[model samples]
Target: MSRKRVAEPGPLSEHVPGRKKACWGILTSQGSWADRSPLHEAASQGRLLALRTLLAQGYHTNIVTIDHVSPLHEACLSGHVACVRALINAGANVNAATIDGATPLYNCCASGSAACMELLLQNGAHTHTTHAHFPSALHEACKRGYSQCVESLLSHGADPDYGVAHLGSALYMSCLHRHTECSRILLHSGAKVNVGRDSDSPLHAAVRQDSADQASVLLDYGADVYLRDSNNQRAVELAPPGGKTHQLLLTFEVAPRTLCQLCRLHIRTVIGPSRLKQLPVLPLPSLLTHYLEYT
Candidate 1:
């Protein structure tokens, strides 16, 4: 589990003053290992002993691969909590970005590891880091149906609407993937129910994916039923013909909201996303509080 620090002059011997040795020699030691360093491999495979030994032998924890992916990114992407802790403890840059601008926090969310996510956030990982493909950590969590990761990101103030431009909102992603739990969590956290890109609303995305459950959840959260997509089709029109999703949307479109429901929706809008969690402790009746909380 240990490696000798050979003092030979080679690719790893060109010492940048004040910098740890780059593990480029280790990367070229095997044909199968193309761009990854020894630290990246050990951290990626959860090889704690090897990872610890590499750090102990003065291998730079901040050394990045050709794509600018550090060992910390590998650790978080693989959900290797021990490796993540080792890298963080050894002064790995938690906010280091890949060539596409993805951070270790975004990788953790992609892997659906709340433990790694919490550790990264506690160690100063930026939740707002967006990549070319992913808009935010919250968007990654929603796309992959990681409800726990989504909740963790929300609690840490990850914006639910962070990626509206490229990937659409987190709610839209969750609905597109038919992740009812993630959609519920995002809605309860005050994600905009009707928010979408120019092409589709969350409801349209849900029905297009044929997710009746997600579409129902969106309706319950007061999503606008009559919203149109870029194709000028309503959500009900996009639903599968003679399918449950179509039926549900048709019912919602025909049935008018009760006065109490309208009042609850207005109250939620007035309180805004920040104060939505306070509805439970208000002086309202338990049933009313539950209603306001979208129980």
Candidate 2:
């Protein structure tokens, strides 16, 4: 007896011609159709078989969507491990970026998907490349408080000092976002505690946030306690008045502003005519008050 050959089912007879067809799990025209391939959609839906078939059919592995997003980026963003694996196996560019330069790891980090991030890492997704919006995977993980993701990134040798948009590095983002644990990890992993931006230190950003704990953490990590900003205001000036941040600054022995001292001396010079004639006088509060009344 001859072996029988089984025929695969053809395209669904009810499928409308020239209308959108579901190929490899993506709703699009036929592979030979004139329009673009739906790689992003298939990758996004975790349609592993369709993705493999598309690749086998010589469809461009890096076909992008209307937004210029790649299939690998879609897989990472959607947390589709299988799709990601298939795309990687099919020679999809692991580090292929969208128009804005966001890699697969950036997408995984944005989603806080550690599994996806790990897969991307194992597959050589570039962790150092930043998008126009954000820099490294560590920055996104820190911003989102994803400690596991952060740790995975660190373990993979992702630098915690990666900076973006001239705002400074991953440690800078961690401090600005007040992710204490993540910041601590970054600090221990060689992130610069005093990574300065526009003359402000991590301590200054922490002070601006009014988080005494974060300030103390940065300080303990060697952040410059006396760093000032563009307005000539130091960390102490940024702290909320009468809060624990205020009480805590005294422990650091930071001197208050001398503007009040200069104001007192100038007032004494203007009002105390007799004292000015006698000699220079220290502008004690009592002497200043006496001059106010005498003048």
Best-fitting candidate, scored by lDDT:
1
Global CA lDDT of candidate 2, please?
Answer: 0.69
User: Tens digit of lDDT per residue, candidate 1, span 1-295?
Assistant: 0111334334534556654443454443342222567888899899999999988998888877656778888888889999999899999999887767788988888788999999998988877864445447888788888999999888888777666477788888888888999999988888889997766889999989998999898888898878889888888888889999999978887886889888988888898898887787788899888888877
TM-score of candidate 1 to 2 decimals: 0.86
Which window of 10 residues has the lowest lDDT sum in candidate 1? 1-10
TM-score of each: 0.86, 0.68
Rate residue 133 of model 2 by lDDT: 62
Candidates in order have lDDT scores of 0.81, 0.69
Alpha-carbon shift of residue 93 in model 1 (angstroms): 1.3
* Per-residue lDDT of candidate 2, residues 170-223 (tens digit): 777777888888877776555677775657778877777777888776765456
- What number of backbone clashes does candidate 1 have, counting pairs of residues 3 or more apart or in separate chains? 0
- Give residue 104's lDDT in candidate 1 (0 to 100): 90
**What TM-score does prediction 2 earn?**
0.68
